[model samples]
Target: MTLAPVEYAVIEFGDSTVTGDLVPALTELVETGLVHVIDLVFLSKDADGTVTVLELDDLPEGTAAAFAGLEHDIDDLVNETDLQVEAELLSPGTSAVVIVWENLWAQRFSDAVLASGGVLLDSQKVPQDVAAAALAAHLASLD
Candidate 1:
């Protein structure tokens, strides 16, 4: 099955902040058919942030196991090392979510980073060429 392309917002916060909201939003996105799953990348200040991605497969009733199969399809099409892989896994029907925690959401996390002074960065959505290159590169490296 072909995937859909979607857009999402990522909320970044400090250590041990309000991270519970992400799952529900992702679930909603999946339920609405806006996206199959969300790739959650966590960015933090000086602490050296690590990106952790979770595909929301616990879909609401009525929908097929599309998300269940998506993980493998995405993994096959995109290289694990490429950032675009996340975007590629999300079909045109799906979208990528970039959660950057800041004021209003996580004051402590926002304040801590500001005190130390860290900036949030956004990676551009996977363009066609970039996605193609990543796929091509993955295929080539396989040999």
Candidate 2:
């Protein structure tokens, strides 16, 4: 079988302004056959300088209800050690959402490449703002 492409993202938000919609959004992705969420983790730094970590199973009752449709086993691809490294960058009283997702939409393409004897290459995501700027530059150059 061709290997599935995986991607990870870490998103940070101020504690007072945070509203987590990841579970519902991920559910939509899974239902749409776009991506499969392999891992979901929440990290928070309190004002008292203490850090908190939780996986899907550890979420609060009210919050856990939102993730009822998760399709994969709740696991961590970005483990504790990796989370600690990232936690150091968070400001006090801030929170972050970490997710690892497989590109379900690309499996067919990956299989085709493998069938043609082509090796998989590195893949990376372009930050949205940077991609927008790039598109603007290309459009300007075409004028």
How far residue 139's Cα lies from its native spot in candidate 1, in Å, is 53
Candidate 2 residues lying further than 4 Å off, grouped into runs, are 1-3, 16-18, 141-143
- Candidate 2, residues 11-126: lDDT per residue as tens digits? 88877223446667778889898988778778888997688897656666666667646765547678889999888888899988777788989898988898899986776678
Give the per-residue lDDT digits (tens) of candidate 1, residues 1-143: 22233334533343322234445554564455444432434222222323344333322232223233321223222233544434333333222334321112344565666668776565366778999999999999999
Q: What TM-score does structure 2 among the candidates reach? A: 0.81
Give each model's whole-structure lDDT: 0.40, 0.77
Q: In angstroms, what RMSD does candidate 1 have relative to the true structure?
A: 19.4
- List all candidate RMSDs to the true structure: 19.4, 2.5
Model 2, residue pairs in steric clash: none
Candidate 1 accuracy as TM-score: 0.30
